[model samples]
Target chain A: MSIAWYLAVSGIVFSLGAFGVMTRRNPLVVLLCLELMLNGANLALIAFSRMWGNGDGQILALVVMTVAACEVCIGLGMIVAIYRRRLPINVDELRELQG
Target chain B: MSTVLFFLAASGVISGAVGVVVLRNPFYSVLALVAHLVSLAVLFLLLRAEFVAAVQVVVYAGAVMVLYVFVVAYVGGESDSVGERLRGAGGTGSSGSSLRLGGAILAGALLVELLIALLGTGLEAIGGYGAPYSPGPQSFGTPAYIGKLLLTRFLLAFEMASFLLLIAAVGGVVLARRRGGLGEEDERDLLTPLDLMRPRETGTMAEGVGGRTP
Candidate 1:
């Protein structure tokens, strides 16, 4: 119930997401990790909102949710298109934009 | 009771998040992500952000996760090869060990930074950090309260969000669409040169030429 506990949990989850993003070879898995990171931030926002006895944090969390949805849609659309063009979905092999 | 629920949900969130990152299969990772989102929604409810919690469940867990599942299925299930490659490359070699070591160091550094920022600062550095926990007004996080705020203080933002979502929907449809000239002979003939150049390419070109020729 304490703010510190929530913040600690958020930090751990965010770090895990970062690690996954760094290590995962699959772009889809990377996107999933990004969602984990976003959820971590949302958790912190709501916890702070509760700590402050206000609704602003929750409202911002809602906005973050919307942004996340948009990101996932565009991300998955790109992934699908790429998958269609290439049989395998490997982030390492997606070096065509390395210029 | 609330504290107990928070602890339970927090554990669920953390464990599911770990599963998402640690799972080799994208399908299982998606499942873990769903669990993580749902537990986070529960945590939101415990924090009294009921409306946000509902939105989290409905939008994130229900809709967004379904989209992810569809994509995972569409991309051919169980990309075990990718996982195998990652592990093979990231293990049993000096460079791989160094990379793992670097990742661990980076993660540890982040953990320390967050702990220092959250615990050492005593909450005042973060605006509204010291606000007394009063649960404010009877309708604090109810749908009515959020709706009022959305329509009044944040009306423009709400409208912009909707507009953004509309654009995203159209963009997704456009990006997900298959090429329109797939059935056209002219387009096929045009692509024949490229297909001839790379006959072994494993993609739409190969499929198109193979289907047409055979």
Candidate 2:
């Protein structure tokens, strides 16, 4: 497969993810969409890594994975705290931080 | 063979992503996310990043997804109404429809721009970045090669990542626990050690015991 094909696929997925983030109200779903975007970037990175004949891109991908894991840990923790405070998790209800 | 697999995995990734966005149920959305992750791993394999692909499955599909499913099942309310709110009127009152339309337009524009850029660049331009179709050595993306690079070149980054994970674990625990400390009510609300050991039963203990007697 051509590198262009991979890039195109990555772009499509990233756009879809951006759409999800914009349209979805649920915080968890929004977080999932963010994961989609991250995965799209990872795909592009791997494609470039393959093309470059270098291990750097793959290493960067591994770092991305670690960061993604940490994001999930902290994100879900916050979600749980929110659920406890409000009984239901809704992004629309979280207006306290609005300044 | 590789091209066919790439198309199949790409389709799987796209459809699963759409399902995640379009599905009303959070459970199904999570399932779709799992499908997307697995197929992305397949794509990584096709790209010859075997170690990364394996880590994708183990970390994303295995650990992170399990955490998501647990939170969805245990903590999340059965708010089908939330999904309806998302689909019905966009939930922001007078600005709802406009927001939806605006978001759609924005995303479409982004997709178009990306497609144009990719196509306009020409395949030869991208091909000139490196060796193009050459898969490098047999050990290029293997675990051994990755491990060597991690230990030697990327040692600081790898160590920092480990520290980050440790902090994440500690922060998650601290955040999830009640702030007032383990009071009587908090203790009652929290899952006990015995609760962890026992299988989760649907009805009252009396009902469970009575049913078992029969």
Best by lDDT: 2
Interface DockQ of each model:
0.50, 0.59
Per-model C-alpha lDDT, please? 0.82, 0.82
Per-prediction interface RMSD in Å = 2.7, 2.1
Please report the candidate that would top DockQ against the real structure: 2
Which tens-of-lDDT digit does each residue in B1-214 have in candidate 2?
8879989999999998898877767788899999999999999888878999999999899999999999888666356455456546754554756877898899999999977876576556464434544444547788988999999999999999999999999999987888766567755845567766755565457667777542
Candidate 2: segments with Cα more than 4 A from true spot: B83-94, B122-138, B185-214
Q: Please give, for residues B99-196, the per-residue lDDT of candidate 1 as tens digits.
A: 76788788889878977877678666353433454454556788988999899999898999999999999999898888755686675565556767
Q: How well is candidate 1 docked (DockQ)?
A: 0.50
True contacts kept of 2: 0.62
Docking class of 1: medium
TM-score of each: 0.82, 0.83
